[model samples]
Target: MKKIDWYFDFISPFSYLQGELLHTLPAEVEIRYKPVLFAGLLNHWDNKGPAEIAPKRTWTFEHCAWLACKHGIPMTMPPHHPFNPLPLLRLAIALGSSPEVVQRLFRWVWREGRVPTDEIYWQALLKEFDATPEMLDAPGVKQQLRANGEAAIAAGVFGVPTAVVDNRCFWGLDSTDMLIAWLRDDPFFSSEQLRQAQQLPQGVHRKT
Candidate 1:
């Protein structure tokens, strides 16, 4: 079976949207759900999230809503954007980071439109999982989360909802179709044009 490491953060609306579409991948593929902190990625890459910018933030939400409607997937923005995803990430690790747990968390945040900061909903979620905040805060759980973040950086991941297969990273919800094509042994991946594109020289760099 082909293994794909799907790195995502609960704070990313695109991640939630991607989660809903993972089932469209080839049956031979085995997905490894990796929960990473989106903020950690931004810090490491010296970048800002879309929500940190004004106009782009509005466009992002609007585009996501449009995508959901176009794809016929149920999605609703959480009460807030870019809320702390650490708790949700650790909670997923505490629950073994299984696909079921990951999908459940995504749906809770995106479909149900709730955040951990919502005390009542948070408590209900914990009760349903037969867990507690202490469990999510366990030393091992925290370490695993840290490890996931470190591994993500090491893998050259710069964003959430990235699917890494054979060390090649396909990023964003838009890349889903490309990933599916590549998984199905698309010849473009092995063509000479792709090799030439990889060898293309950089024209210029933005001033720091």
Candidate 2:
């Protein structure tokens, strides 16, 4: 069976969006869910998240809403954007929850639009999953999250909702269709070497 390594962060709306389409993958393909921190990845790459910029944040909200509505999926932006996702990530990992649990977390944050800041909220959520705070507070949970982040960086993954099949990385929610095509062994846009070779030298930057 073919394997797909799916890297995602619970705080990313794009990740939530992509989760809706994960069922489309062929039954023969095995998916491995990897929970990584979006903030950590951004920091590693020296990149800015969509919520970090005012213009991008505004556009992201509107765009996400449109997409949810278009796809007939329930979606409501959480009270806060880009809030700390460590708790959820740790909780998921510590509980050894399946990918479906991750999807539920996304809905709690995105579709139900709830902020996980309160202890009461977390307790209630945990109870629903038959987990306790002690599980989330386990000593190894934090390290596990860190290890996941580091592993993602080492795997050429720069962002969430990424799909890696045999070392080929596909980033972003918009790349789902392309990823599906790739899983079926379809021809891609171009080989990496060909793409680099076709690039034109710009201005005086070339051998001037």
Question: What number of backbone clashes does candidate 2 have, counting pairs of residues 3 or more apart or in separate chains?
Answer: 0
Candidate 1 Cα lDDT to native: 0.93
- TM of each candidate vs. truth: 0.97, 0.89
Clashing residue pairs, candidate 2?
Answer: none
What are the runs in model 1 whose C-alpha is more than 4 Å off?
none
Return the top candidate by TM-score.
1
Q: Please report the candidate that would top lDDT against the real structure.
A: 1
Q: For model 2, how does the per-residue alpha-carbon lDDT over 1-208 read when each residue is reduced to its tens digit?
A: 8898889988888889988889998779998888898988899888999998999999988998898888887888787887888888887798664777888888888877876796677778988989877777888887888887888888899999899888878899888888888878775556776477559566665452
- TM-score of candidate 1 versus the correct structure, residues matched by position: 0.97
lDDT tens digits by residue: candidate 1, 1-208:
8899999999999998988899999998999999998899999999999999999999999999999999998997899887988889999999999999999999999999999999999999999999998999899999988898899899999999899998989999999999999999999999999999999999999997
